[model samples]
Target: MPVTPQPLGRRERNKQEKLDRITAAATELFAQYGVDDVTTQQIADKADIGTGTLFLYARNKGELLLLVQNAHYAEALERGRAEAETIPNVLGAVMAIVRPIVECNRVQVDNGRFYLREMVFGDPAEPHHGQALSIVARTEEAIAAALGRHGPIATGDAATTARIISAVMFVTMAASVNASLTTAAILQDIEAQVSLLARR
Candidate 1:
């Protein structure tokens, strides 16, 4: 039998509304001022919610960042995956998957670096942190899929190579030495490394 899902009750609707407001507020504030400069109280004020109420949505600012950036990262991964589908060359396909992510991370350099820190160090038990980690895993999966499509690379090799590529991308993006580099420059560096790695 076909079944229709029930609509959200008032309580659920209110919670969704509050969450939307919180996300919008945090996104704007984080973009304006890097995550380090923004406070939880400021976020609460921007959201027009009490500090205590904001805590219910996100335990801390790191989690709140995870909340905000996770969506953008997920979108970037999707775009990369779609672009990878159209490119047949292995390196080109991999770069297609990587370019959008690098662009997304570089959107606000400090925020991007801090989000990487939070993803690495934040409590995995936290829901938002888990979501960020999930996006990363999905990114690797997309890369592995791209590799698998191109040549005789075994599934295991593809997965391992994807992990290496992911590590290179993250390190290159987060590295202090590369901090001042423009997105094109960073992409060029990553492409050089990926080209070396993609050679089978």
Candidate 2:
């Protein structure tokens, strides 16, 4: 007779156990030595697992970095989207979209900084380029829809406004990537810049 499979609960517990070990090791290693400097063998040793075991969790360090970055962005985006749904005004909605990204910098500035560096300016060999570009385009489209729904932007073209909004967000994200500024301070600066643009 064939061997019986494990229960779902047992399988899930096993998976979580493995993931916990991997994530914990990754955090410690990445914090101490940075992502690029940390090796698969080192991560496995840190986690008290074999190199083969580490491969079960992550294909490579680059993949691990993508996981860390995507997890944060997913959380921030969910928070921002939920908050935006609560506001009625278009500008408020726009601000809602920005607020989560800003809040990320407030709570995990170093994490945000690292992600921005790898994402916006990392090597062409990086794997998440398409995903990052998709995110940028999606965010701009969301803003454009909001603008078109509420009132005309000064440009009168929602698509153009969306592109402009995307550019502004990109620039702000780049600036804060390596700077010492707080999220609230960055948001204040953005508000001033946007106000000036509106007045023109």
Which residue pairs does candidate 2 place in steric collision? none
Once fitted onto the true fold, the runs of candidate 2 whose alpha carbons sit more than 4 angstroms away are 1-21, 27-42, 51-63, 123-129, 153-156, 176-178, 196-200
Query: At residue 53, what lDDT does model 1 achieve?
Result: 97
Report the number of backbone clashes for model 2.
0
lDDT tens string, model 2, 1-200? 99999767987898788777888888777767777677888888877888887777667776666555565566776677677677777777777777776676445555555666656665545445445555666666666666665665654577777677667765775674436876777787666655444333
Per-residue lDDT tens digits for candidate 1, residues 48-163, read 99999999999999999999999999999999999999998999999999999999999999999999999999999999999999988999999999999998899999999999
Cα RMSD to the true fold for all candidates: 0.7, 5.8
Q: What C-alpha lDDT does candidate 2 achieve relative to the native structure?
A: 0.67
Residue 149 displacement in candidate 2 (angstroms):
2.5
Q: Which residue window of length 10 is worst by lDDT in model 2?
A: 191-200
